[model samples]
Target: MTKRVVHYINQFYAGIGGEEKADTKPFKEDGPKGPGLGLNGPLEDAEIVGTVVCGDSYFNENIDTALPEVLEMIKSYEPDLVIAGPAFNAGRYGMAAGAVASEVITELGIPAVTGMYEENPGKEMYSKTAYIVPTGNSAASMRKAIPAISGLVNKILAGEDVTPDKDGYFPRHRQNYQAEERGSLRAVNMLIKKLNGEEFTTEYPMPEFDNVDPAPALKDLKNATIALVTSGGVVPEGNPDHIESSSASKFGAYNIEGVKNFKDGYESAHGGYDTTYADEDADRVLPLDILREKEEAGEIGKVYNTFFTTVGNGTAVASARQYGEEIANQLKEDGVDAVILTST
Candidate 1:
């Protein structure tokens, strides 16, 4: 029997518009649209019964409302399987796709799949929660991504066993069945292979480093309201917030208004690097003293008084991204035009 599938995509793919149309609300079209059209050939017996197009910004900003509304639309089609984007490296689009895939799998209790690059933030946050096929970094990979995604969807809907290595998807790290050998035995066998210079595949693989594209350079540095931020874990003298030296749970905002030197009472809370030098002078890490000089010298405009700091060591990329986002939002609202970020 042919399976009915619902395709989810962002406004840009729907040919509605690009970032300018990213605020478009959730809407449905009768059949395949944009990339959904690419799926028809490879999907074989499965048909895209309806296409759900939502704006990247709107869905993320209003997820609570958007998710249910999107799920409702997909439900209208009564699809046996659901597919979201091969979102590439787009941060917001990847997030929306991952989210839709998550709900389709968890809430709808159906086979759902999305594709994205390994480094996409959405992969880090949702890959374990959903079935995510790894794709190239851009839509240029669309042709290749479609078949892989569809094939897996078909296999899942047909109740076929799929492995991460055999199929090109990220590992979900779920142990749904029992292993013949205990974990200790497997570890010992793998260790012996390692010692004997033999091949071994680890059950769990470490995640790749996150891909963070830096913001565009400031066109008007002399007029920009610059802010200071650090992952060096620099904080007040007494370590008031007690941000962990490693795997910091939270970041802190401190007032540096008109303060020239960190030596006044600042120190490094970072545990990754040697603290001796940073202890004597936090400026060694944050360099706010030099920034103040730049401000006074009129080389740049005003310095944003509120400086943000966090410890990067052993902190998950998800946590770091959350901190960066929260800090960025406040900085944008406060009219801070630019930021000088330092890391150790």
Candidate 2:
């Protein structure tokens, strides 16, 4: 039996436009468009019955409204499977693809698959919820991405058991039952190998932590200009930058020139933690008040007028790294000698 499939893609892949058209609304077409063209050849018995196109920004910005609509469209097609982008490393596009694939699986009870770079924020957000095939960081990888994704989709539709290592998808971390000796025996063998200085693989591997060398102590605290940076999601009242409560895509730089304390108008946008205390006095998270007190006491030099903030909850390491680099550059340009970075 021929399996029906629905493909989802953003505006850029639909031949509409690039970032400029990122606000385009959701729409549907008869079949295969953009990368879908490559996907069709490798899809085998799975036929793409329809293609849904949406702008990355529009889908994410209006996810509440967009998801139901997109899901309804896919549902109407009654596809046996749904496939979303090999989104690469484009943050918004990757997010949209992951979201759509997840929703289709959960809400529609249909098997769905998407592809993205390992570091894409969407991979972190939805890898466990959906099958995300690994892809290169840009559309230049489309040729490679399509084949892998299509093959996976075919396997999924056929009810074949898929493993991350063998299938090229991100690990969902689902435990697999295996017939083997007890853990104690395995540990004893590993210890023996370690004592003999022989290479051995452990059944469970510990994650390596990144260690940062501490910077030298400030030589002149009373003269150094200090700056405040936070991942606590503090923003002026309205959250003008629209920074997301989770998986933040950007950071905001706010001027605190003569502000003595963060009050009612300042609140936390972080969704990972309770906002009660942080909202009442954002200084609890950013510590602008303490810094001010230290400045008044001459314990430290002036505080930089501007501070950088973003929600760190579930934020991708890549995005956080980019924000850090950009923030550091701006602080250096503004003559900040040191920074007090706070996080929830």
Candidate 3:
């Protein structure tokens, strides 16, 4: 059976108007045309059964709408694989390709692939989610990226096992079933050989995560009263609360009547990093001194004294949550509203 593959492209590559038509919503075409020929030519066992073209603007602006509609159209064909542009240097186009490929793979569980230049920002964003081949920064590299993806798609359609090295695509930490057996015993022997100054290659490799998500901004600061909390330990001298140094289950609160900030006697017992600086001025980590300054400046309504603490670095999530709840209960009793938690 000929492998049926669906191709996705932007308006510019679809031979439609360029930037002016970048707002085009998705539409289906009968078969390969223009750039689609590149994919069809290399994929001898595969045929471009359908094509989806959308304006870059429409894809980026109305992704929720465009993706579902485009997916609905592609679903009618029931292709074995979905392929999108390895969008070279085009920023918007690269992003569109990544977005569409990720959506199709996630929604349909169909094999998906795309190509992008090494320096292309899209590679950083979506390479792990889909099979993205390395390409040049110009249209000149299309020939290379297209054929690479096509070859991989053909193998996938044939139900053949493909690996990161053999398929020539960026890995997204996805695990595949290994047909050949060589469990732990074999692996240990191979390791022993390597330790004996013999060259050896391990079939399995560790995966990488090149993507990161920035922390979300604090919500509702205008009308909400904010509190201060930290992983820094600024408990009362002589360790009155007896809070555990690292995986603390309890939190402490000190009376800041005449205390401008934590003195030399107050210290952090966290085992993660050097807490020397923070110990000298506990406010450096908790920033109660700054909050007090802000309060004196009328920047905030109130400064909740004696911020919460726990050693974040090796602390179990369950312990952290329990400690948090305890401190939160105290804050509630003291009429504390919101919290500014500083993590190390």
Candidate 4:
């Protein structure tokens, strides 16, 4: 079956005015318009079923508000896949393409792809979320970029295996498997050959992260004794671990064993927000003071004295999980009761 593909572009590509039309809201159109024609013409099993255009600023400033509406538009079409820009280097356009592509892929369970220059900020922001082809810095490369995007769309719609070099695009961390055996031994031999200046193909390519199921809600928070966890790097004064404010090295658990109040002396190093609340009183974040108050008031069971803290920004998902697991194990061992984690 030919895949029903939808294309996303900014107002300019949709035949709307220049910067003036950048704020175009999504509306269903009967067929391709503007560059949508290029995509619709060559894509074989795919048709440009819908075009979603929004101002770059609109998407960035109003993402929370815009996403639902955009999603609602996409749902009406029921496209088999979604495609967005060969955005070149237009900053806002690149970001809009990536953001829309990622949301459709995740929220709607549809495959989405985008194209942008290596320098575009969106490349870094949404590269992990969807297919991002390396594009020329401007529309001069449109002919080349569109064909590349078209080829990848063909492969995706047909469920064919694709590679970075063969597809003429940067790797999106998507992995593919081959039938023939080329175990680590053969793979290292190939790598050694490449190192010695011989031609070789890598055996295992880094695959994009499979869609992650949202973290399951804490089970039985009221009865099962839920513990609070955050990567928001809420920590005590001086950051004893010297953990960087954004890129944390290791999480630390502050011992509030005998401390009565988080007043006067403590501080937070978390850089996401004004650390004042977390800093002026670490208790505001760890809420140890409040938790203790609650425990004393019989509002809850015993308050766990030591709570875990770590930097949330730029922290890898893997590192966060490891911290949680370690802290959870410790909590189980110490017989500390439920936890209430506060984020900064």
Candidate 3 global TM-score = 0.52
Q: What is candidate 3's lDDT per residue for 41-62, written digit by digit as tens? A: 8886779998889987677557
Score residue 179 of candidate 1 by CA lDDT.
92
Best by TM-score: 2
Q: Specify the highest-lDDT model's number.
A: 2
Error of 2 at 334 (Å): 5.3
Candidate-wise lDDT, in order: 0.86, 0.88, 0.73, 0.71
Q: How many clashing residue pairs appear in each of the predictions shown?
A: 0, 0, 2, 9
lDDT of 4 by residue, 1-344 (tens): 76787777777777777755555666656567777788888898678877776765466546678777777877778898888887887666776788888898889998888888876767778888788888887899999888888888889888888776787666666566674655867877887998899987765656476475655565443334334455666656677876545434478877666776666556776655777566666666655566566656666655556667787654444456667788878988976445555566
Give the TM-score of each candidate: 0.65, 0.82, 0.52, 0.54
Q: Give the TM-score of candidate 4.
A: 0.54
lDDT of 4 at 213: 69
Which digits, one per residue and each the tens of the lDDT, describe model 2 over residues 49-69? 899999877887688999999
Cα deviation of 266 in candidate 1 (Å)?
A: 25
Of 1 and 3, the candidate ranking higher by lDDT: 1
Q: Which regions of candidate 3 deviate over 4 angstroms?
A: 174-344
**Residue-level lDDT for 4 in candidate 2:** 94
Using alpha carbons, what is the TM-score of model 2?
0.82
